[model samples]
Target chain A: MLSIPIEYYLILSAFMFIVGVTGVLIRRNAIVVFMCIELMLNAANLSLVAFSSYHGNPVGQIFVFFVMTVAAAEATVGLAIIIAIFRNKLTVNVDEINIFKW
Target chain B: MNIELILFIILATIAAVTSILVITRSNAVISAVFLVLNFFALAGLYLLLNAQFISVVQIIVYAGAIMVLFLFVIMLLRTDGEPRIFSDKRYIKYFALLISIFVFIQVSYLLLIGSPSKSVTGNQSASINSGTIETIGKELYTNYIIPFEVAGFLLLAATIGAIILAKKKFE
Candidate 1:
């Protein structure tokens, strides 16, 4: 149904992945960084869906299913870790929480 | 010219803009809100690509469950008092922006110029029904049964791990 080139979707997702990387590198807030990671995942999922549709492969959709599962799990554990860290450090700023920074 | 193209353009734009906003916003709440918008836009894009099941799952899992979890965590942590935004070490922002722009240009050049006429001709009938719930469910039940079970176990493990990690006093 889509006549638009796959490159367009790939490029858009590429832009998104870059933005996520930029956010991860520069953002001080750890929560914001996690959100950036989600953005990157979303971008990857987009490209995967695009390729899947173009090739008419249900395998790609299956992989996307697995990805969604992993993402959900990752978010839960990651956020819980963040909460625990915040409890101990009283801050979510990456710059400040440097107990392991030697 | 076509309605589908127009919809794709609009959704892509929304996805792009909302993602940028999610990253740039200093306030975590605002970022969470924007991320929801981004997810909705992505769901639209998936719908365009004939990923009917994925689009629904994206909305239910990512937008519905995951984002609500994010919002809950953000509210729980409450990091608003700390001077929101580029107060110290501002150079990191510039450096990151420079690197991201460089990477984006490289990728765009590769995708737009390096690749020539990349297209996939697939079984039209297969593709038409590939996105339907029936096909995905069948695949999940048959060929992907092992992986599906593994995912369930992984989720169970994650739930236990999260509970353990977030406990008030773990000895």
Candidate 2:
């Protein structure tokens, strides 16, 4: 079986990370921004798994499990915060919900 | 040119394209759907990497549970109305786009040109066996047990915090 170079996975992860960053920067919708953040997290997870396989170690894969767990927790808390903000502000757009803005 | 490489190329293409779609679509729900696709494709990539356990968890936790939470929040907020796509200043967007492209080019150049410090000595069969569910379980329960339990506590705290935040009032 032919094997793929690890650089391919790293490059793909970088592309995904950049896409996520662009989404976070440009999208006004807070939830979409949250999705973009999730995208970034997933991109990092992909790289971690890729490197784990490359190094012949299970540590990286185990770390990915923790990352996923944290991500789940983050989603729960994040969505709750979003909902609270939506309830108080009546909108989910980041630009409009700037009570903290000076 | 072989089957594994071909599969990798196909899955990577699907992942990259869907991730782009995830961020570009105007509808949040549509974006979530695309993110689900991206997760599936990433799971396939993990399988290719011989991280079978992580691949399964990627599907279950990411594509299944976390996305459902996102969708639930989306429905709860009723964010169906088209939100403003960008801030009033269009320059910020252009700047962001430019920065993203620059970062992409820089990273790709480094990835393609840099010699990775450690040479990969992992045999395919060894990696496949090492990444098996049984191996992961044994390692997780033995060497990494403390972190595993701490993660359990973190999840519990998150659950309580979410409930508190979503409550109608802090009576």
Candidate 3:
């Protein structure tokens, strides 16, 4: 039963985090940006679980549980905000929705 | 080659590819579908890490509930054929690509050069068992009870706020 080294998990997490960052940087759709944010959150969750397993501590997993909770709340509130904005602006494009721009 | 390692490689590939598709797809619905696939793959990875409870929760919460919410919003908004902004900004895309490549190289270099210190706790079997639902339940109910209650309150507030934000105005 040879287990994977923790470094592999950490590296994978890093890869996912970068992908999420790229998505956030390039995608102009608000929903897509939100999804990328979710991806980043999931990346962090993976690292926490990996370290939890490595350290033989249940604490990290508990933290992951909290992260998931926060993610769910975020999605709910975020989508609602998007809907509200779309109602007033009739668009979800980040560039076009800039009413605050001078 | 061990079966666990093989499973990990296959699952990791699936996760990576689907996540790439998630961000690259022009169609929002298609991206959402790919995101669901990515979540499933990640759940598989969680299983590999011996976090059975978290894996199940990942499927239920992410792939199940959250995705359903996303699809509902997509359909409600009817954003199909919405003009994508990716083509309008070539410089941003190139810059993002360059940054991600730099990050990947930096992380790979560090991971390859630095050896992880061996675990000093030494009870790997016991630690592995801590990821089970039973063990997680005990910890959640005991030491982490206050945080759990706070999370519950957070959800309650979010639910109320969402309703307020999205509710129809009858005036």
- What is the TM-score (0 to 1) of candidate 3? 0.94
Candidate 2: tens digits of C-alpha lDDT, residues B5-45:
99998999999999988877888899999999999999999
Q: Where does candidate 1 chain A have its weakest 10-residue lDDT segment?
A: A1-10
Clashes of 3: 0
lDDT of 1 at A25: 88
DockQ of 1: 0.74
lDDT (10s digit) by residue, model 1, range B58-92: 99999999999999999988696435456645777
Q: What residue pairs clash in candidate 1, if any at all?
A: none
lDDT of 3 by residue, A19-57 (tens): 999989888788988899999999999989887876777
Q: What is the TM-score of chain A alone in each candidate?
A: 0.97, 0.96, 0.96
Single out the weakest 10-residue window by summed lDDT for candidate 3 chain B: B115-124
**Number of the candidate with higher DockQ, 1 or 3:** 1
What is the full ranking by lDDT, best candidate first? 1, 2, 3
Q: After superposition, how far is residue B125 of candidate 3 from its true place, in Å?
A: 1.1
Which portions of model 1 miss their true places by more than 4 Å? Answer: B81-89, B121-124
Steric collisions counted per model: 0, 0, 0
